[model samples]
Target: MDWGSIFSNAMASALGPDAIVYALAAIGLNVHFGYTGLLNFGQAGFMAVAAYGLAASVATWGLPFWVGIAIGFGAALLLALLLGVPTLRLRADYLAIATIASAEILRLVFGSVTLSDWFGGSNGRQQFANTFYDMNPYSSRLDFGLFSFSANDAWVFTVGWFLVALSCLAVWSLMRSPWGRVLKSIREDEDAVRSLGKNVFSYKMQALILGGMFGALAGFMLAIKQQSVIPTDYATDITFFAYTALLLGGAGRVLGPVIGAIIFWFLMTFLGGFFSSAASIDLIPDVVMSDIQASLVRFILVGAGLMALMIFRPQGIFGDRREIAIDGR
Candidate 1:
């Protein structure tokens, strides 16, 4: 079954750009869902707007990359305000619905024919990452036995992982502060926090903005990795996968999402490659599952695995049961 190649490829995928992107996204989700008790089901929307912000600013308006970065953060902040002002005081599910709906609406609008000129209407934007790659220090490919990457990917990884480290450090530091404790207290019981004279809504909005900024950074990393932006790239499915990563790693723990992202991609690519190799060697009947089916079966297996985890250990690999016991109310 060519286990060597399968394992090698899986390892590579674990450390690849996709893993970095999702790790950042899941980190943002951890802040929203794990720490703050926010049901932000539209994290992908944050990522989308950020990506388009950079793309449109650079490709359409001929702005510099740094300007694009500013625009991206602005868009994310605006989106957070738009979503939080009317919904933060409502039920948790209301925020979920609003975020998910806003994300879908934004995706459709970006791809709409009327906005094709600005957003490129489905094909997305390209050639916007030159500035990032131009700063690469490596002149040759990096081969690390089980994994290898191009010079460009090396640059992306260097910047992306650095950002991830900074995000984790920020989360770690913030969660230890008095404000961070208040956030957790609010998560456990908002009414109590409110009674104690803390402005619950304000804290929630701050967390939203903070987390959305993290998501925007992920979007920037992703856009730079692909050197382009597409509406479909930020689909709701991305948010779900990120959530899966958060749950797998143990949400609310500073490193949970990061570890979860690594493990999730590792298992996914490993199982996928293993199944494809087995099918190629005629160990599995074609009628039972084709090559395409082999590729997709991993997600089914992963889904079942997640269900098992939720049933047996809902707190996840690193989560404390008491921490997640907080009422969403």
Candidate 2:
């Protein structure tokens, strides 16, 4: 196992487009679950809709990439409104249930055979990113000795990071204002905010829609990054991973999810490569572990780490304990 290669790849993964994608998604989630205490269990649903929205728009409707972007955001905003209006008035778990159910429903609907002509069904849609790649300024591949990326990936990384920065800056600015204070107040006690004559429901709707739009941006980046949109890629696991990023970085804080996404991807890829390499070449006897064992080891390690994080430091690396203690509804 080439340690240098493993380390370089791991670092590249941390700093590459994958990190940017997850960071964008996690940041949006921070707005939802972290600050607003929305318990939005279907973040991937928003991402899926946005991704497919872009792909379908361009592939079937002959729309421009920018139009697809708008469509994606519009779909996510609608999803947020649809999910929030019905469930936000209820307890936290109800929002969670509705979100998760809605996400799965969207996935199943997108995968339906009836929509295959347009959505490509289970195979998903592609060729929606040609216009995006056509905007690339760099004609040659980019390399920094330790790692390298194709011209296409570099363009994706550049745009993706830009979106992440914009989203973070937006969150930072908003969280410092009176409006942000209202959100925190609602998280602490909606009843208290209501008593103060604040329109709690409106605030909740705004939070949901904004967060969902952020998720939509992430989905847009993901769609262009991969140059494709597959329904399976936006599974519930993506939501779990994004949540891990939020928990790892700390919720409610502007920079938590970005830091969490980088670290989470780094450790995950690094440990996975390390353990897999060690298990190979008979470093570990088959009795103790086989090649197949290496595959499951990373998930177990990452899961245990997440468990430890929740148990010992629920507030995350950047979050104070108070940040995690939302209204106990």
Candidate 3:
């Protein structure tokens, strides 16, 4: 098994845009579920709204880059309100039901052939990122000991990492403020926070809108990173992946998603390479696995491992047990 290749691929995923993208999304989720205890199963819906906002703005309206960004964010905020208004005060399960349904509805709408003319329907959109790329600062390639990045990728990395840093800092600062305490309190017991005179519903709305916007921002980055926006790309599976990254690194911590994304992608890529190489050499018989089965097998293994982690070490690597423990009574 080419150990060097395995390491390189693992490192690439760990340090690359995939990791950063998930980290950004998970950070937003950390706000929704981690600190606020809001089970927003429709985070992907939020992202979709933002992605299409940018895509439609430029492709249909010939808008500038900043205008597209504002449209995306505005669209996310609108979705958050629409999702939260009817369900925020209903109860946890209601919020989940409403969000999940809303997410699917948005997906269906985007994929509907009726709006294909403006939204691009099943085909999606591209070639709408001239403005974002115009701001790239790096003029040449950047290299560091066995790793390097082309200038465009460097701009993405630079911008993505900066967003991650800013998001984390925002999370850290918010968690330290009075509003943050209220959010944590709501997570523990909304009734208790309500008794203390905090508008529990409003706080949750704020958290949802804020986190959903961050998810939308992540969607924007993802679309711009590839210069495309497709409905299927922001499916519920992506939301689950963001959740996986959040949990793997331990939720409720500012940097948990960042660490979780690194670890998740590293393990996923490295294990895939290792298993494929082992199969190529017949180290593992076809009875056990094959190269063709590697992709599915790695996820199965990770899922089992995560199941075990939840059973034994529920708080994750950097998480404090007190942080994740629920006293939902």
Ten residues in sequence with the least summed lDDT for candidate 3: 320-329
Candidate 1: tens digits of C-alpha lDDT, residues 1-329: 78888998888888889899999999999999998999999999999999999999999989999999999999999999999999999988999999999999999999988999999998999999788899999999988977789999988888988999999999999999998898888878899999999999999999999999999998999899989999899899999999999999998899999999999999999999988877877788798888877888899999999999998888888988775566433
Ranking by TM-score: 1, 2, 3
What RMSD does model 3 have? Answer: 1.8
Per-candidate TM-score against the hidden true structure: 0.97, 0.96, 0.95
Question: Per-prediction RMSD in angstroms?
Answer: 1.6, 1.9, 1.8
Q: Tell me the spans in candidate 1 whose CA falls farther than 4 Å from its real position.
A: 322-329
lDDT scores for all predictions?
A: 0.92, 0.88, 0.87
In terms of lDDT, the poorest run of 10 residues in model 2 is 320-329
Error of 1 at 61 (Å): 1.0
**Steric clash pairs (candidate 3):** none
On lDDT, the stronger of 1 and 3 is 1
What is residue 216's positional error in candidate 2, in angstroms? 0.7
Model 2 Cα shift for residue 27 (angstroms): 0.9
Encode model 3's per-residue lDDT on 117-157: one tens digit a residue: 87888888887887888898889986755567777778888
